[model samples]
Target: MHLAFVAFLVAGISDAVDGFLAKRFGWQTELGAYLDPIADKALLVSIYVALGYYEYLPAWLVIAVVTRDILIVGAIMLSGMINRPVQMHPLPVSKVNTAGQIILAALVLFDQSFGLNLVKLTTITVWVVGLLTVTSACAYLLTWFRHMSAYEADVHSSLKQQKDGSQIKPRHFGQNPRA
Candidate 1:
């Protein structure tokens, strides 16, 4: 059981390392896209369940963390249904949420030896961070819808322009240096 947690902790650290390597060396791969979050959830869920068993973290906190992941996954599915790509840009709130979860998890695994009221503080922080995570997830959904709507509108306008004898071509993003 202890070894499982150590492995999970190392995987959690790799989450940061993976992102750094990806951005630094342009080593982004589709496999990393799938594996990164899978590894994150694996580590988080493993630790959460283990800590819950030990009564270090509350069951409800575990639920919140898992539920947030589900909601974001649902958003990704919705975006896919719309034929729009859901890219993972690390939003600040999401980063904060991740950090909060890691802190909370570590506190739980550490058996709350510190006099910082780890359980109470982590529980409160979980709720606050959970709200931010949900909001950012919603923002991603809204951004996807807006992007699709704008694309459709541009297509419609382009068709109209063509019928009206305008010779304008629909411009690709960033194709023109002058905005």
Candidate 2:
């Protein structure tokens, strides 16, 4: 348990430190953009699954977290398959959800390592994490749906214009045709 806590602390702190260093020195790269989230999710998901197995965290919460990640990945894959690739920009709610998950994981580990009975606090944080997880998933799904709809509409309009022998420009989501 102590080792687990230390490993978690190192992983959490190193992420922040690395981000600071990257920005401070302008070391950002495309590879980092892809790997950073993968690392974060890998750590969080693994920890959650481990804790859930030990009955330290609820299994359902772990399932929800994992499920949300799977859905996001599936959406990305589907978008690519249809030739409309997704460019994800993290939402504020998603950031909050990540924070909540990290905090809750730390709290749970700390409570176990030191034998601190933080049941009430743990319960509350867990629920908050769960709520944020679901809400953020919904937000991402809604955004993806809207983007797909807009893309389809633009394609249909362009095709119709071409068939009608008229020059018409189709606008994408958040784009102005007049501009």
Q: Give the per-residue lDDT of model 2 (tens digit) for 39-148.
A: 89999999999999999999999999999989887987787797766665677788999999999999999999999999999999999999999998998887778777
TM-score of 2: 0.88
Model 1: residues with Cα > 4 Å off, grouped in runs: 17-26, 49-55, 112-117, 158-179
lDDT of 2: 0.85
Output the worst ten-in-a-row residue range by lDDT, candidate 2: 168-177
Q: Summarize candidate 1's per-residue lDDT along 1-179 as a digit string, tens digits.
A: 45655765687677778799898999999888778877777777777777777776667766766776776677667656865444555556667777777776775555454445565666676677567656756655565456556656655777876776654332221122123
Top lDDT prediction, candidate number: 2
**Model 2 alpha-carbon miss at residue 45, Å:** 0.4
* Residue 30, candidate 2: C-alpha displacement in angstroms: 0.9
Q: Which 10-residue window of candidate 1 scores lowest in summed lDDT?
A: 170-179
